[model samples]
Target: MNNFYKNYSGIILLLGGIILGSIAGLVFGKDVVALKPIGDIFLNLLFTAVIPLVFFSVASAIAGISKTNKLSRMMGIMVIVFLATVLISAFLTIMAVRLFPIHEQLQALKITEKIEDKPLADQLTQLFTTDEFYQLLSRRSMLAMIIFSVLIGFATLRAREKASGFVRFLNEGNEVFKHVFILIMKLGPIGLGAYFAYQVGVFGPQLFGAYAKSLGLYYGFGIFYFFALFSVYAFVAGGIRGFKRYWANNIIPSATAIGTCSSIANIPANLNAAKKIGVPDYITNVTIPLGATLHKDGSSISSIVKMAVVFALFGRDFNSADAILLALGMTVLVSIVEGGIPNGGYVGELLFISAYGFPPEALPPAMIIGTLVDPLATLLNSTGDTVAAMLVARFSEGKNWMDVKEAA
Candidate 1:
């Protein structure tokens, strides 16, 4: 009981906070907004720590890569696999949201402060880069900062033996920020509770609005994608036999992913499953571990849904081509920064808040969405790594690579 409580305490507190806040709102009505300042304290702390957290976590994850791992062809193919799967996920989620809008009463719910309607060209420029280095420090520049972090990581990679100290600093910084997040979350019950009260009181039914539909859509898609899409990926990699091999050996990895709900935890299971399913050792060696940190088809799906719900809550049209294009681009960047942080979804959630100029209040709902969808999302995230290894092997070897391996 103590062990279980210790492990699940954060999630328990968070949900308890929301439940208590909802009750308070029901009892007290509009006066609940008075409690909002307390919630704002939590948001402020998260926003302050989040930028540095992302910088160090992302850079450190990439810099930790040892150049001695000479699986260049496999690595290149792995990049293609990661990006392609995430793109597909983002689009599919976008389509799902488009076909079944998360919220119906957009005009009534739109927030007073909105992101300025910039020309597409200007929006693109701002989204991708900033004029000054200091600008990257802001959450509004999260996408730009992510790009910058990736560049710094690659530069460190280029420096090789000379960059060891800098890499160590990044790792230490990441550890520091991780603990900071822990301390901040210690305050989550009070903060999230107070905020939920304000939302329920001020917005009425809007606090509970569309979250049910959104979560339902996510779970449905996750299940369908898990069985149907994975089989397709395996079939593509190795033909009918490849499909058979994947499903045959996938049970343990899938079970571990579902039970643990941590991508990193599922790595050994994925590596073992990949080996059994006939992935070349070199491909599995490079892809599964790295994929735990760098690739995230499931996170990609959740991101778009979370963004769409935020848009709906703020009274924006997420289905617009421009809105969706920007969302997909941000989804890619979020997938990069999101994978490497501890309690990492906070960075990705805040990225949406900052990038879209959503008020700080927008965060809790996104965090809630992340928490709700995490299990199935992790299932995809971990399993996808093994399937990706199979794809990399297919490309790196030949059409009959699995057959060739078996013959030997």
Candidate 2:
């Protein structure tokens, strides 16, 4: 019993948090505002760990790459897999919308918003960073840090003897920071409990009913995407036995993704899951982190569903050939930008309106749909990450790689 409880504690705590929090919120209403500090503290700790972890982990992974050719091969394969998963996901979402049409009135949920326009040149500069060290300090610049860290890793590799100590320091720092992050995660239940409660209190029933048609369609198709699409990816990587093994091994990451609703927060769990599924440490380290930032099948599909809903609300024709192509394109762009942006998926829906030239009135409904499906979006994103890592292992390592000891 103790061992069983230990094994399932995170899931237990998460469910307990959501249930009790929801109850408390419904019972206490606005008074639930008192619980915000508890959730805030936990979220702040998570945000604190994100930048250091991404920097050290990715840099160490890249620096450790012995053959530069292999890095390119791995990246090339990974990008192909990521794009395939996303495009297929978007296609499925479109089919789902066509199969079960959503019809509902958009509630007037008043919310003000703005998206800052950074030109292509500036975006490129920010991605690599003109001042690498300064941009690393900026919490918002994850892409910049990733680019800078990879460059540093390559530099360290070229100057191995001279940079050995620095690389060692980075590896050691990664271990230390990872341990600290785990320590912080020990408080996840308390933090998530309060946070879940606040969410329920603030937007539970009202939001659900307001966007029920779209939310229902999003989740319904989301389930199909998760089980059906993931199974296909697993089967492609490994046959029947391998497919079963992957799913069994994926429990931790799956639960973590659903509970946290943030792929970044789900990385540690994904790492463990990757190892259980027989991906080597080297590949897992690089692929999972990169996947967290890039593999966003969930957001791609959800973006389409949100667009369809917003279009329907405006009596706009979403079935037009131009709209279909626009959604496909926007899905890719949005998935790329979704990482590390605060409330990014919600804000990303604005692009749907802007892309289709919809009236400004469509923004509120888009926000509503996006916010409601955010958790499932994270699940799809993180789930795809774990699968992508396994696929990388299969391509780079071999099929026999995953047939080893099952993931605990």
Candidate 3:
């Protein structure tokens, strides 16, 4: 029974939640108001473990790196790969949005009045102001949290003899936190059910139609965009044959992430897939774990795409300069600066919107759009991580394409 549950639990929970939520929504559509608190509670519970979990995981993982030089090299490659993928995703999303504009009969969708765009300097000032800065960090802002975690981790590593006992304690604590996280994740079905039920009850079927057309387009575009990006990494690391085999082995992890919409929860599967694809244990253990935190191709793409969608909704055309700048800037910013901190997506989205001067009312709609695309985003992010792991393995093994092919 334990083995059976381990094998099929995610699928059962996800489908069951969707089906039950749909039924409950149909029956209690008018009473969604009552379900709001339940959904909120689930979200609160889900996020409650994020901070401690991240702090320990990151600190331990970094401190556990045996050597500073190897750690730096691994991180360097990871950063480069992360940035490249993000840029490609962002560019593809921008093009797709332009070609398949979300609003065709733009006149139908009400355009909220534009807010005054904040200057970059002012926004930076606000971002760094002591109170605001503390709030961002306290809230587990992914970017800030990551920065703090990395600093502490590095400091702990340098402390070496002085902090050996403390580091050991943190490593143990990280493991304990992971166990707690696993326990919480097992309750995902209930939380998803409650959240979905609330959404259905509050909005009814009418809400589906509201952004159905735009969402459909975005989903289709995202699918194409992801495949294109995946292909590039596969080809660079290995040829078509290698790529096919690599992808086949990775399907389980990719599929799980898509269904669960949580990369962290899918880490075990991802690690397994990496090893299956011949990625070394060292590379897989380190890169895959870290990638789960920092490499969010899906989130980055969706953010840029949503920005374009918002622009279209407001009947504003993004000229080439604006489009290129937004895509490149967002990709670079998200890849390097955005830490795999808890609730990083929401924080990044809010900051993006505020910086661009998008209307306040636009946030709700943007969030709604994000929910629909989040699964795909998770898929892209997980897939990208696998690909990066493959690259790292290739480089570390000192194997060329010919060598890889011959080995296969």
Q: Whole-model lDDT for model 3 versus the true structure? A: 0.63
Question: Highest TM-score among the candidates is held by which one?
Answer: 1
Please provide, for model 2 over 142-164, each residue's C-alpha lDDT reduced to its tens digit, 9 standing for 90 to 100.
55665677788788888887888
RMSD of each: 2.0, 8.5, 6.1
* Alpha carbon lDDT at 153, candidate 1: 84
lDDT (tens digit, per residue) of candidate 3 on 1-408:
575465446546655875587578878885755765665555555456655666676677677666657566766776677777777777777777677666544442343464443455554444334345455444324435555667888899888889999899888987787667667656655665666666566556543544676677667877876677677777677667548757788778877775556667778888888777777676788888778777778777777766765565555555457545755675554543333322235434544554455544344445556655666777777777888887766656655733553577
Cα lDDT tens digits for candidate 1, 297-378: 8888889888877887776677778888888877777777775322456667888778877888789888888877877888
Each model's C-alpha lDDT? 0.81, 0.70, 0.63
Which pairs of residues collide in model 3? Answer: none
Residue 211, candidate 2: Cα error in Å is 2.1
TM-score, one value per model: 0.94, 0.59, 0.65
TM-score, cand. 2 vs. native: 0.59
Candidate order by decreasing lDDT: 1, 2, 3
Task: Give the residue spans of candidate 3 off by over 4 A.
Answer: 1-66, 103-114, 121-153, 160-210, 310-362, 396-408
Given candidate 3, what's the lDDT at residue 400? 71
Worst lDDT 10-window in candidate 2: 106-115
